[model samples]
Target: MRLTMLRGPLLVAPIALLTLIPLLVVLGSFLHPQPEVWAHLSEYVLPEVINNTLILMLGVGCGVLLLGVPLAWFTAVCEFPGRRFFSWALMLPLAMPAYVLAFVQVGLLDFTGPVQTLIRDIGGDSSWFPRIRSIGGVVLVLSLAFYPYVYLLARNAFLTQGKRALEAAQMLGLSRAQGFWQVALPMARPWLIGGLTLALMETLADFGTVAIFNFDTFTTAIYKSWFSLFNLPAASQLASLLVIFVLVLVGMEHWARGARHYHSRIVAAERIQLKRWHQIAVIALCSAVLLIAFVIPVIQLLVWAKSILQEDLDSRYLGFTLRSMMISILAASLVSLLALLLVFIARRFNSRATRWMVRLATLGYAVPGSVLAVGVFLPIAWLDNLLIPIAQSMGFATFQVLKGSVAVMLLALAARFMAVAFQPMDSTMQRISRNQEDAARSLGLNQRQLLWRLHLPMLRGGMLTALLMCFVDVMKEMPITLMTRPFGWDTLAVRVFEMTSEGMWANAALPSLMIVLTGLIPVVLLVIQSENKQD
Candidate 1:
């Protein structure tokens, strides 16, 4: 019994410590002073970073709510035209990363791009077009890319609320609109807030979209400080500020959702049906969103890929594809395994300390990849510096260790994505009956046997879901891979960044399309899962 009890903590502590280290390293920048850089940033750059970050967050928050909530409500509550198709179609945008969308939009809509050229050919001046590299453009692109988070959560919330609550509101002398405003909206508040929080976190952590737009934010600042200026301290400091911003947003989300129970009586009830014009309006709304968010962007990428296929399809491109898949598979497997172990331990132990440790381990997902890269790099570099001299003294000349290695990149990926794996595993575990374990134990099964025979088999679906999601996320990841990958270790994301940087949008399209295709696996799985739930 004692040995069994001790096992959980022993298994959990090391992973928890590993997860916390990067955050601690980033936060430790508060103690160190970067006088000259700090002074210059504080007076000029810091305010702009703060202002832009806030504006981006606010803009994305509003944009997501505007796009996500209404669509979620329509799909969940009303029987509109194309309701069946839009139910899954609305989620397609989740596969499109904000950065890829940014490039595609810019390539299509910029002053030098086809749209403006066509307008110019038709006699429109340059001033007739809105700039595609501004704050407004960033917000639109990010919103289109990220609103699915809000839509998914809000749709689930509305579905879970069922028809009874809305009926009750209608019986209370309230109109459908009034019921939605007073009851449905309030009940969905927690979910809406949760979704908004996720969108804002992604926005805050964004490096590629903002960088492509040349819009300065905390994430951009962190990247520039470390890579451009070669100032680790300044980068760390900027990362610290970004972390604080994330924490504050998380805290605000918690406070906004405080002590609120949004549960409705679960009953099988008929959904609200819309009339002809209302149905048409709902269909049009959903179609417009889908077209703008997923269809157009994907079509543009396909066209670009078609244009460059013969020239870009070669050994080097294949190498990049293989490298990306290899790293993503490896990282996804590691993160999913770790998440399973952490969750299993937490369930078996069921202690406050163990639970909190698990929670802390999962918090890495909230930290931006850029910040995590900086946090991870500093310690690994220091360790390499310490070990290199010792190796030299032992007659091993020119031996280098951790810095600029694939291991560091994998570690950073694991830290950034473990939460993605954990959430699904945790939710699945909650649905599992504890009696199964007790039954196994009565049959003389030990913990290991019980897990292998019972839990592992039952957890197959969840584990795969977690693994695929992590794989896709790692494939789309930019900042961590950019900062930590070894020499000549360029992933597809790096290829996209490089080509886009050099204004090679056609070349960037192939890899960008590959990423989107890879990402589609999880999004398709998500749609299937949601449909299964509905069924």
Candidate 2:
């Protein structure tokens, strides 16, 4: 009994630290926030922030569904020449970041841009094409990059839908359209909501994309409060408000999913078939989506990228690229490891509180990094302040723990990217049977032995998925790096944003391409894993 008691904590220590980091940051901020900050913020800030966030969330949510669901429906029911490519091609937008796509589109389509310049030279002016910087443009850009979130979920849901159910619908005198509406759509609503919720959260949390367009959402306000005004307390207040908005969205998502769990009536149902009209529809649908999502933005990037080569691609930025990749890879791998440990512990103990905490921690995925930095910086800075003075007072000479170290960056990565790492592992774990563990226990195996032998092998793919996802997130992440990076620590994302901030694309494209390429690794892997599961 003594040994078991001792071992439990020893086993549980990792989860404690994982949870403790964010908790410490949030609580610590409340204790020692920025001085004299309450007087500065306008009361109007809160309401405007909340309304803008909700508007963006709702707008992006609607736009993505409009684009994703039809494409998914067409591709599911229809056959086409590029049908095989359409199956996965629709998911490609996920590899591109919203801000990058947004800027690239503006660069190509903006007045005095190459397109407009050509138009003006040949008898055209400002009124020739609408500016791509308006709210509609923002909505268009977001929908393009984000519709993949909906596509994947809805497509998977459609693919797994049983043929028998649809056949029964036909037998009941329902037409194909009626069957899809009454039978298929209801079954797929859960999955569709799951995707829509993700896209909604993403839109609410986006800072860079909104800011570039001069949109004043809550995330932008938080960044202004923290970086421009240098008021950490007000930023926290704003962030706290932002968290409420996020939670409301999250709660609604949870309520929707809980209310709409779909059950299959028949076992091992047949796949639905597609025909020639479907082929034409699928082709047109895929082309339209890709036109908005991948082709237009990429063509714009290619244009700017060529101009960049005309500018410069020297040695100064090369080291930053290496540094960025090295740090992101390390942070991603570390967080993935931490997530596996936490998930393993959660599985063994079956703690509802622990599961809730894990779910809460993943809320970072939905939060803008600008806001998360406040959440991260508040507690650690307070802790660091207390420790640095004590360490100097005690006359130690080793190292400082928090303020200006890679530890802070890594901790931020763990806090932010944990969800990406945990999700795949959690899904994989659910698919596994407990018999292997029971059998191992009966055969004189320790828990560690059983896990190493049985669990690790089964979860290898999930582990890879988690690691790659985390790595890509780390690579593309910006807000935390901007706020919490140590004195001279800049990652690939930071460098890209910095160059783009100056309206310089030549220097940014290499790193931007790398970020997109890096993000694609996990996306491709997930697509393959999804295919394998289907097979």
Alpha-carbon RMSD of each model: 1.8, 3.4
Q: Per-residue error at 92 for model 1, in Å?
A: 0.6
TM-score, per-candidate, Cα-based: 0.96, 0.89
In candidate 2, what are the lDDT values of residues 1-535, reduced to their tens digit?
A: 5554345345656555554556445555546645455444455576666666666776788899998888776555444577667777788889998878877777777775777888888885657488787878888888888898898888777776756657889999998789989988888988899899889878877776887677788778888887888877777877766666766887887887785447643235545566777656667778888876777766666666677765566675676787787877888888788778867877876655556556655656766666667766777777877787678778876445877677777777777777888889888888777876788889998988978887898899888888878878877777777778887677677777777777776567767777887778877885786566453
Span of ten consecutive residues with least summed lDDT in model 2? 264-273
Candidate 2 lDDT (Cα, whole model)? 0.74
What lDDT does each candidate get? 0.88, 0.74
Off by over 4 Å in 1: 1-10, 264-266
Clashes of each: 0, 4
